[model samples]
Target: MRNKVTKAIFPVAGLGTRFLPATKSVPKEIMTLVDRPLVQYAIDEARAAGIKEFIFVTSRGKSALEDYFDEAPQLEQTLRKAGKTELLEILKSTNMDSGEIAYMRQHKALGLGHAVWCARRLVGNEPFAVMLPDDVIAAEKPCLQQMVEAYAETGGNMVAAMEVPSDKTNAYGILDIGEDMGAMVSVKGMVEKPKTGEAPSNLAVIGRYILHPNVLRNLNRIKAGAGGEIQLTDAIAAEIGTEKGVYGYRFRGQRFDCGSKAGFLQATVAFGLARDDLRDDLETYLHELLAARKAAE
Candidate 1:
């Protein structure tokens, strides 16, 4: 029997250069989506997926991200004194228990593989999930939870997979598929950010993964693959022919690449519309904005 995936890794070391001025003072992971921060959504998802230990791979200028998870004592006391039970309860959800979380610093911007590797000591030899908060996913069942259920059946290694446009395949780690198993596909190989028209398939790897520790070992062998960075795709691909072969699971969710400004705005709008209290006003405002733009055009 496979040991449960009780640990999860969050790689939030990126400089968020795409969001520039806004990220100058703020860690991108703490940038709020509607009301809650991106990191909160990721933590909720990880907890829902049965992750017992949380690990964050961080870098410089990320103190804000670290503080976000810490308990807000003064604020909680203020709310509690005001008889604001609901609000106080909301604040309580954010506190991570002692020893429940561990943060490791990634001194250099080596890449995804290196960032994940930094958490190796804590992870040891167990299977762990890696979640990229930037890829905020909206799903009936949290994406990682869906993956955990899937992982139980196929225990080697699993990466969340999604079908993207054929031309857009170059932007992702395309999977060379073996068997067509509906929602789950057997991964024969991985092509990291393939050149235009060089992609073998349109099924691209996403940000959530149930990876074996061997992938961490593989990271030591890879110097750099694409973008002169140690690509996680290369490490995962190394498992293909080994005993722990990789599998691609098409998750049930709509993922937003919040690393980009446009994607961030889009997620804000989508999440705003999803909320019962905000829906009517947000939808009305969006319609008015569209009408104004069309009138100008």
Candidate 2:
């Protein structure tokens, strides 16, 4: 059997300039959906997938991201004094154990591929998973967990794939499929952000990936691709047709592209509406907002 995927690399080095002034002060991963920060969601998903060690590739000014996993002694004390056991438990769940977490700085904002490569020493020669906190998936089974189960049987590189509009293939890595094997599709090849009407298929790759260690070495072969930064898709594409070929798993979940402002707000509403405490009140406000907009129109 293939080695168990105990380690995961979270490439959180990107500077969230799109959010602008807000990101200037807060790391985008620490931005909240409702109460829990986005990073928490990713961590929870990692835990659900049986991930043992968490490696973060952070850049400068991402101290908040590091601090988020630290224990909150003062807050825990206050909850203890107030006899709020449930509240204290909720806060404690976010803290990582002493050696459970590791951080490496991505000195430069090279790209996603480079950010992950920063954790190579920690990852060693074993297969590892990569998760982008920017992609928050809501599902009965977390997206990464679903992929992990599939990886056990398939034993190669796998990425979370979902069908997208043909016109929007330019925004993502398009998969050239080889076989339709129910939940997983054998990926013949992939093209990074292909031009409109030039994509091989509408199946776009998302943020979750289980990659072989050789892909890390493959990063050395090619120069930078799109955006003048090394692209992860290019490295994965090079593995096509090999013995350990890549597969695309169509995960069962609602994924939010929290990389954009609209996606973030949409995720907020979807997650908020999923909560029992916030559903009624949040739904009422949404209806009111829609009615007012209709009236103005």
Lowest lDDT 10-residue stretch of candidate 1: 218-227
Cα TM-score of candidate 1: 0.98
Which lDDT value does model 2 have at 271? Answer: 95
Q: Model 2, which residues run further than 4 Å from truth?
A: none
Q: CA shift at 190, candidate 1, in angstroms?
A: 0.4
- TM-scores, all candidates, are 0.98, 0.98
User: Which regions of candidate 1 are displaced past 4 Å?
Assistant: none
Residue-wise C-alpha lDDT for candidate 1, range 74-117, written one tens digit per residue: 99989989999999998899989989999999999989999999
C-alpha lDDT of residue 249 in model 2: 98
Candidate 2, 135-229: lDDT as tens digits? 99999999999999999999889999999999999999999999989789999989999999999999999999999998998987768889999
lDDT of model number 1: 0.93
Clashes of 1: 0
